[model samples]
Structures are given as structure tokens and as C-alpha cells.
Target: MKHRLVTATLSSITAAGVAVALAACAPTAPDSAGAASSGPSDATLTVGTTTDVVNYNPLIGNSRTDDWITDLMYPRLMTVSNTGAKEAQLATKWGYTSPTQGYYDIRSDMTWSDGTPLTAEDVAWTLNEVKKDKPAGTFYGQLGDFASAKATSKTHVEITLSEPNSSLIDEIGFWGVVVPEHVFSKAGSVATFANDGKDGGWVGAGPYTLSKVQVGQSYTLDRAKNYPLVKGGEPIAAKVVFRVFPDVNTEILALQSGEIDAIGDALPPSQVAKLKSSSGIKVEEAAGLGYSHMVYNLDNPDLAKLQVRQALSHAVDYDAIRSVVLQGQATNDHSSPIMPVLKSYFDSSLKEYSYDPKLAASLLEQAGYTKGANGKFPLNFKLIYSLQDAVTSQWATIVRDDAAKAGITITLSGTDRNTYLAATNAGKYDIYAGNFAIMDDPVTNFTLAYLPGGAINYTHVDDPTLNALIKKASNTTDEKQKISIMQQANKVVYDNVYDNIMYTQNLFFAHSTKWTGFVPMPSDLLSIVNPVSLASASPVKQ
Candidate 1:
């Protein structure tokens, strides 16, 4: 009855009317429920972490930690398994509906903790709504491959795109990143949907349901009983609680004091040795599909020159930074914007620019940037970095200091994540230091930084050859052929030093012996709480 009134009254409202209409359904409660008895020993696990879930909607939050909690209940159609294979979870079967259309068969037995049916309508609604939102910048990744979506039946959805898409179903549906249609169909600002702390205010169909939510402080999730994938058993842990800390030190302290059983943030390399020596703490590391790199604002006169860009790339002591920062835990990167973790697409033969301070100086001199009277190039760059990202800040500082050896003058600016991303995407920074959230595939990933006037390409890298290759790669259906073309284009981008990628990241984590059965993932990009990783998590046996 409540849902009927909501559907008839609010779904048809205009964009202007939506804000007022959905504002009432917004009276919220937490997401998910379960009959599983909350136990004592392994029943409750409190995870220490940073960042807060400011919004319940996965598509809108500014906090990096929001997904760590929201994903618990929203559940996806599929996810990348710990073995790196495509693992289906939510959608039982999927295939092409037409040349440019795809269809998914949602699992039938699933339901919200409230017993509301978890249907294909939710999947279709999420895709269609994201398209309607038309978010810019990094948010563009949320909409995935669908141009639009529609549910033909309660259990079937067809997603249509201009071209046959091979990536979206995995990236978007993996781990059930979408929210329930019944919850959001009447939502005005999806961003404010999780504003209340009432029971069942949130809605999801994952293994766990959110039992309580106190944004910025803590979130508690209860294991959904008889979750289909668990073989009619509940998840290993009955309750999972996440608490936020302001920084890494506080998190580490919480673990040591036994106030928390684990942490979600990747522990930086500088602290690994100390944690490794602590009794009862287990450290886990994984190969990364992510990379941290510096991007140039090519609009600037100096960075616009290929020689100048190449020289700056040569200025950083990449190996030294890697050793000091990563403590030999990461793999060396190649020149390509794509991380080497993608076995098929990464062309390891392409040489990265070696750290050659002398060569850096010569290139600058040859480009008519010879050391001026004060012994510095006329270029004065202000590097914008995220204040919360200590590693990126250190990377920026190291580059700033090293560039001086090549007579390059650089100023460092540290701002919060929102400001840093906004400034970089708005083309306000000369150089930006950050990590690239590459997609599951190389072709889609490269478009962010390589396509003609690419959305996030601050470098203004509008190379005709790369643009043509991007088009060529996107047109194909053959896996090997796509790899062949993307690698070729990747080499071209590397040749021009479009962006200086420092290393293929190796994200690390540590947990208490109080819990175990965790199956480590190939990349922390999928994270510990993701379906595949959580499937392997059980209490450490005596």
C-alpha cells in the first residue's frame, strides 16, 4: 500500500516536482534485514576506516568509503571473482538481445530484507536514472555502457547502447552496485536518500542488510538469512560494523587497542614493517590494477611542448620513490597510461622514461628553457594534490623537488579530494597528482585520458592517431583484436609522454587474527568487502 501510493503519486513528477515529491518518501530507514541470530564471537566485526557515507546512493557520494558500506546491501549482477574470472552473482544468465542490445536474467529468489522482491526493474531503473543524471567527470563511469535500460518483465531487463558493449554488465553489475527501484523510483535527490537512521530506510538485496546507519560515525549491517549464494546459509559474520577515523594513525591505534578487528583502508608501505611485527595482526598484499601518476595541464606553454613533458618525466627518481614509499611491495610501471596488470593489453616492451636528471636538463635546454639568471626555467607550476591522499602529496613533493634539478620551478598545493578533483577536471591546475580508477577493461579505461579532448584528460592530449585508434578499438568484438589495437594506441600515447605514470600500484591490507577465511583479490580496487572477497571470509578457527 505504501509503495502503491508512492508509485502513482511521484514517479510522473517533473524534474522540478521531483525534489518536492520524493522528499517525503525520504523519511528513511536503514537497508536490509535478516532472521539470523546475531552471535557473540564471530557474530560482530567492527572495521576501522576513514571517510563517511554521505549519501546512500552509490552514484552520488563524495566519500570513498561509502561503497564499502552501500555495496553490502545493494548487491550486483556479478563481480570479478578472486581468481580474476567473471563470476555471476545477482543476474543468473545474460546475453545479447540484439546487435546493440543486451539482456539479463535476474535471480528470482532474491528480495530486499523487507521481503520486497528484488527485480530487474531495479537494474533497469538504475541504468536509466544514471543516464538521466548525466553526471560529468569521474561520475561518468557510473553510467557504464548503457545508453538506456528497460525491464521487459519483473525478472528480465534489456540494456541498449549505440554499440555492443562487453564491459558494463561486469563493471556496473558486479557486487550489485545499483540501488532498488522501489526505493529510488520516487527519490528526488538520490544523494540525500540515506539521510535517516530509521530501520529499513535503505533498501538493497546483497548478502548483508544495513541494520543501522549513523553517517560519519558508524554503520552496522546484519547478515541476510538464506542468501541464495551462501547455499541457504547466512553470511559467515552476522553483523559488520564500520567506524571512521580521521587518519591512518588513529586507525592503526584502534586495531592495536582491540577496539576494531580490521581496517578497510590500504595501509601505506611505510607502516608495514611495524604492523608485521605486531602479534595477532596479519598483513595481506595483492597485485594492483591501479596506478598513481602525474598529469600535465597541456594548456600551459611549457607542459604543452612534447620535449618539456618528456624532460619532466625524466626528472623524477621513480625507483627511489618506489623503494622509499612502497618498500619494494609494488611492480615497476611502463610508459603506457594502462597498468601492466591487464595481461593482454599491457605492452611491456614499451620503455618508460628513465630517471635522467642530466637528460632532463638537456631536453629543457634544447626546448629553449635554458636555466635563466636565477638558474630555473621560466615555467612556474602549481601542483594540485589531495590533502587526504598522503601518498599523492608525497609524490607531488618529490617531483617538485626533483624537477628543480632540471631547472624546473614548481609550487605545491594541497586541497581536499573534492577540491582537488574539481580543480583538475576544471583545468585549473598545471600538474595534478592522483590515482586513476581504471575500468575493468583497457579500451574503456584509456578513453578517460587518451581520447580526443577526453573527459578527464587535463593534458589536452588530442592526438589524431590515438583518437583514430580509440574509434577503431571500440568498433571491434574480437577480444584479441581489441587487445592488439588498444596496445598499439597505448604505445602511441606513451611515445608522446602524455602522462607520467610512476608505478603499478600494490595495495596492502592488515587484519586481526580474530577473523580469517579471507580470499585475497587480484587488486584492492575490488576491495575486501566485495562479494568475491567476502565469500572467503570466515572466522579464524581455533
Candidate 2:
């Protein structure tokens, strides 16, 4: 799910009403049930994933790889709990010294995999470098409100934000994953960071250490011997192999045949049903923080017209696609960009763009788009989607159909994900379809999408008013006030200027019935809780 800014404060715009209306069905609670017993003994877990972990170096790492490494190597001062609260991790306990400043008491038991004592300098160094190079790391943008970080003692670290932010602890909990500053002081760029993953430059203080890696096939990790959290201080399996697959189908086949234990991206509902019926395999369908949407490039001359965009939103049949392609497994979203299960920051008052073909035609006509001599709307466009993601291709087809009815003609273009990304960065598409991984916190979900130049803000929105609202939402430390302002901003984005939002997906992951101890996270994003927290859980006895 994509990260968004916190909805801190608002004037209670009419949009708040729509937010409340949508929250009536907001996804809550995980889907998979607890196993009767724990997972297998230090059995080397053979998990399957589709992509390569971009980087293993914590300071420069900011993807699924970070979540995987976070569990095995380094520890955070605090971590987002199942309930979305900042709970103890490396830090035993913490509290605020003032409204905008706080201190964390490190746990005496924490240590690096190398047996080095985990101290406050490591925390200070990690965060200081993040502040210096804010754009380098994915989550560093949140640190713009940070003032200074100081080590009061060997075990105590203090953080002072430039302004009040209620979600400061949540952000800090993620940002607190410390890195060995001593290692990366020599590496200077993103390329060097990529090279670090294979050369063992991607070091962490977690329970597993990088053992060996093959560029595309697999990477091996060994149980950290000095891990302070586990009972035995290491994994039962001496070596864990993370095998890579070319696509979801190949990974699913491996899982069915017992060649792999788990897969990352959830299987579609049809495939999930098959897994449920299988003897040893079990399907876990969790309320995912994942959201997929249609993106309209504002740079397109025709799409820049608000009337044309509205007509397209009105004509598109999201419900039909949700039923046919998604098998009713997804939910319709029309709010503060698709948010996760933490809490509904959805503004209830904004009007939902309902499907009305007649209205769509009228809006298109009003936008000065007329059918050309070829018996189609003069608008010639391309729907760019990833050829690799099957579900996105389905959405593109539905969109293509809806636009045709409105007298608009579209050309379909599908390319491999990496090539598509390269084209997208170079401003290549007229419209695209994709999903954003929602973070556990509201700010991380809302602002990250609408904020100018955010990681996923491919639309290139630069509205001064929206930017100002985002600034206030991030700068203010208070929760209630921040939420209000965020709601107001959400209204502007949803009603007047949003590109397109079709549906937010509910994730469904297929795992083995015998595997226990995996606490399902709301977001599709994965963590190493099994290795760290569930390592001691014993499997159910048949």
C-alpha cells in the first residue's frame, strides 16, 4: 500500500459526511484464524516472492526487503502493534518529555547480530543521516518536522520534532530501525547501495544475517546467533532460503507441490479457493491495506479538463469489475486515497462519483469532445498497464469499455513492470492502473499520495492550496486538529481534483495449515514476526 499524510485537522467540510459513510464498511480484523499450535521447528522457511529485494542496507533500503531484514537483523525503538499502537521493540518503554519532544529507554537485552551492544549512537547516526538525505530513504520525508535527535545516555534516545505530530511515535517506530553507520560512511550513491546487497553491505542487527546471494534466483540468510529476542537466540533452521519466482503462477505451483512454504503477494480469489480445498495448503485472506486505482495523467491535454475527468469517473463501472474480475473480494474506495485498517480517515461528506452513462455523455459533450468522422470520440488515448500484473490488465479492459461508450477511443498498451516503470518515470502514459500499499498510520497513507512529489504521486499535482494543507497536516503535532485539516484536504483531492480511484483491494495470502505463529498484518507488506516473535511457536500435533 502507498503511504499518505496524516489527516490532522479540518474545518469539517461536507466531504466528512462521505468519509463516515464509507467507514461503515471499512476493513477491520485479519482474515486467517489462529492455528491450533505453533509453526514448524527451526525449519528453514522457504518463502516465495516475485521481485528482488532492491537493497539490504538499512539506511538506503526501503522496500519489502527492509521488512524482511528488519525481523532478522536490526530492531526498532518501537514497532507498530497489531492494534496500531507504538509498542516496545528495542526500547523497553517510552514517554514524552514535552508536547513535541520524547525519550525512549532502550532495552538492556538488545544487541547486534555481531554481538556489539546496541546503543543510542546507532539510533542517532541512523536518523541524523536520514534527516540529511531525506529523499534517499522512502520514509525519511516524514522527518521534515524533526528538529534534533540526542542521546541522553547509552540506553536513552530523545527526539524533538519541529512541531507537534500525534503519530510521531508510529513514524519513529519505523524510522528507528538503526543501521551500522560505520559501514556505509564510505558508500555515496544509490548504485553503491544496490551493490551492497550482494557484497554483504546490507547489514542489520536482526536475528538473521545475509549468508549468500545469487542476483536473481535466491538469497540465503543464516539465523543470528546473538539475537536477544528469541529463546534459543537463533532459528531452528540453520539456513533460510528465499527463493525467487518469475511470476505469481509459478510461485503458487511451487507452494502446491510443497516446493515452497509461503508466498508474498496474495493469490486471486479463484486460486485462493483452490488452496483452501488442498490438503496441506491453507488460505489466509486478510483485510489488506492494499488499494488499486486508475490513474489519469493530468499532463494529458484532454485529461487536464476537469469535466472530462469527471465524465470518465462517472462512466466507469467499478462495481461490475469488482464483481467479475475481483470476485467481490475488493471494496470500492472514494476517499482519502485508499487507507488501511488502522482508523478511517475517510471524509464522509464528499459525494461519490456514481456510475451514470448518460451523465458521462453529457459531461464529455460539455468538455468539447465530439465524435469524429470515424464514429468515435475525437479523444485518442492509451491505457498503459503492467503486463506482469494480471489483475491490473483486467481493470484496464473494463476502463477501455467504459470510455468507448462515452465516445472516447483508447489504445491499450501493456509492458513488463520494470520497463513500464521506466516509461512512467519518463512521463510515458496517458492513463495507468496500479495499487498502493496503505501504511498502518493515517498520515503515512493520506499525505504520501497527495503531497507534492511523493513516491507514488505520478500525477505530478502541484496545487499550492493542497500543498499548504499537506504542510499543516504534517507540521502540526496534535492528533485531532491534524485529522480535521487532513479531512479538509482530502475533500479537495476527492471532489475537485483526484485523477481516478477504482477500488481498494482486500488481500488474500495462501499459507500452509501446518504453519503457525504468523500474525497477519493489515497491509500486504510483510515482516519477520515469525522469525522474531513466532520462532518459539510449536506446530499443532495431528
Per-residue lDDT tens digits for candidate 2, residues 1-542, read 11122222222223322210000111111223342232235566667766666656555554454456445666666544443545455765555555566566676665665557778877776676677665454557556567778888888778887775555645676554676656555557422444355454456666567777786788777766665544444444456667878777898999888887777666765576677788988666556555777667788988888887787788788788888888888876653463434355666555557888778878888887776777677787877776656688777888888878777777889886666666666768877677665455656555556577665666767778878887777666556777788777777777655656667676777765655545555556643233443333234445
Give the root-mean-square deviation of each candidate in angstroms.
Answer: 9.5, 6.8
Residues 392-490, model 1: lDDT tens digits: 766677888899988888899898666776687678988878876334566666666677545567677788888888777765656677778898888
**CA lDDT, every prediction?**
0.67, 0.62
Weakest lDDT window of 10 consecutive positions for candidate 2: 19-28
Q: Report the number of clashing residue pairs per model.
A: 13, 55
Task: Determine the C-alpha RMSD for candidate 2 after optimal superposition of all C-alphas.
Answer: 6.8
TM-score of 2: 0.84
